[model samples]
Target: MTVKNATAVRLAEILQTKRLENPIGNALLESAARGDLRMDALQRLVGTEAQAHRAELAAYGTMLARYPEHPAADLFIQLAQLVYAAQPKLRECAKALGMSDAHSSRWPAERATYSFNGTLSWLAVQGSQAACALASYTDMKVYFSGCTQFAQRVRTDGIDVPPEFLAYYDDEGSEELRQLALDVVQNGLDRGDDEADAVFCARLLEESIGEFWQSAAGTI
Candidate 1:
């Protein structure tokens, strides 16, 4: 079935009506897209995202252990692997932004910057498979969009980042992962998971993501 028919999609549409995009988050992306973002702010963005990648791996591992026999377990495995592989590329992004090991090691990770990861971990332990899948998928769409835009605009302005790092954010393989998430949502509904729970989780995850963006914007 098409992802459009997924219950998560329908519920997400309704959820979208109840809230708006965070303006500060929008401004952050706009600043990056215009290639006008401050250097320190850009470093913070990469550093925070790198921290998130590590946190996501932990969350996925927890979900895998929590729901071993479920199909969503495979999604968790794939997500963990995907994030692990992306780490080297993100390190390259940090390097290109002039964030060396010494520089980044001194960067303190903010608790507020990790609200999304914290929420995901909580969902892994306390929420349903549908909630985890739907909320994760929603957050992934936003995160991936921001990465793609950042790469494109930075490259357009002749930034020194590696092409491989920029190429990693391309549209090549994301659709399949998205389909997997949608399939998990479908399986979830078939097994009597609560649709409202999924929607609520999505709301919480999205808000945390928005907060991350807003915090990043404030640094600029």
Candidate 2:
């Protein structure tokens, strides 16, 4: 069955709240936060060097293109829909926080970037492709851990990031989120659908990654 907008939002909210409470969740969230902070700082320093970052995103996108129906892909698609549905409220949140979409022009781009990274990591672990798996896992570990640092930067630098914007990286109380993610992954594994799932997730990642890069370049 296709994932509905309401179901997606509920899943996201549940995952976030549940996942944040676990140690693994904390580690992953913190890592991602750090990466985000670094990206933000890099953007500030280099101004719009979108080309430099394109290669990394491209590599990631390619990896994700391998798994369209993966649990990660399902999660991302849900996230994209939820974010789109919440645009009105999200915009309001951005306005209240005095944040501009200048850094991340569209919600889809933000969702793609965040979800792609996680999916890449998950695929690496599940896929038997030695080289890609190693690289993706390494990148995933670093990205998740970096999230904490990014959150810190937002607080310290007085970055006007809205809560909704932060929600993508918010692992503050996400035990349920972790459980949901785990359930998806385990189910795929148990059903021996891991390979198929990876391919599905990969395809979604590839498309969204390209879209994100295009949006960033166009913005520049």
Candidate 3:
């Protein structure tokens, strides 16, 4: 059954009114029953999503603060800021590299905001950012080496980015990696129940991102 998009509370009320059989909805109700629902993410999930840049930056900060030594911790911190930069430049780079227009459409400019509580939404909006973010966390020496190279590129290439971030745009095999990253992100988001526990999404985020870092390392 397609879950019509709604905030957690609204989704719960609708599920109750319709007596729907959604596991997520049921979980939300259970959380509410236990008075442990994370109403912040749910309430902040809609209308307020335009805060994508702020929200993602804050998320990275929260995660880094929460888990600073987790191999990919610095990667996450850098990638969040990278997403903001890559969000604007992704499509143009995709076009320049002669990638399929179908993929190019996915990286459109106006669609570069975060999608809250929706796996599909996150998949769509942050797809390109996801690709680049994953690339930065590769444990492989070569891929990990690219992180420094990207920083160099950021400095020499000088595309209006800050002086500190080591953001990179790898036209080489980026499309495939991006698609893979998006798929992994989709999997994590799909498994997580945001309506129930807001922290679960964040947790799945760390796990999914950590998975990419490990995969990048293994592929070396």
Best by lDDT: 1
| Residue-wise C-alpha lDDT for candidate 3, range 43-99, written one tens digit per residue | 221112223334455555554454454333545555566646654443343334343
What tens-digit string does per-residue lDDT give for candidate 2 at 87-126?
A: 5544444454454532355332344334444544555445
- Which is the winner by TM-score between candidate 1 and candidate 3? 1
Off by over 4 Å in 1: 1-5, 15-24, 32-36, 101-108, 155-173
Clashes of each: 0, 49, 1
Candidate 2's error at 192, in angstroms? 2.1
Task: List the candidates ranked by lDDT, beginning with the highest.
Answer: 1, 2, 3
> What is candidate 1's lDDT per residue for 77-136, written digit by digit as tens?
888998888777767766665667422462436666777668888888887888888886
lDDT of 3 at 96: 40
Q: What is the TM-score of each candidate against the true structure?
A: 0.81, 0.34, 0.25
**How many clashing pairs does model 3 include?**
1
Q: Which consecutive 10 residues in model 1 have the weakest lDDT in total?
A: 101-110
Q: Candidate 2: which stretches are off by over 4 Å? A: 1-89, 97-148, 157-173, 194-220
Ten-residue stretch with the least lDDT total in model 3: 41-50
Clash list (residue pairs), candidate 1: none
Q: How does each model score on lDDT?
A: 0.70, 0.39, 0.34
| TM-score head-to-head 1 vs 2, winner | 1
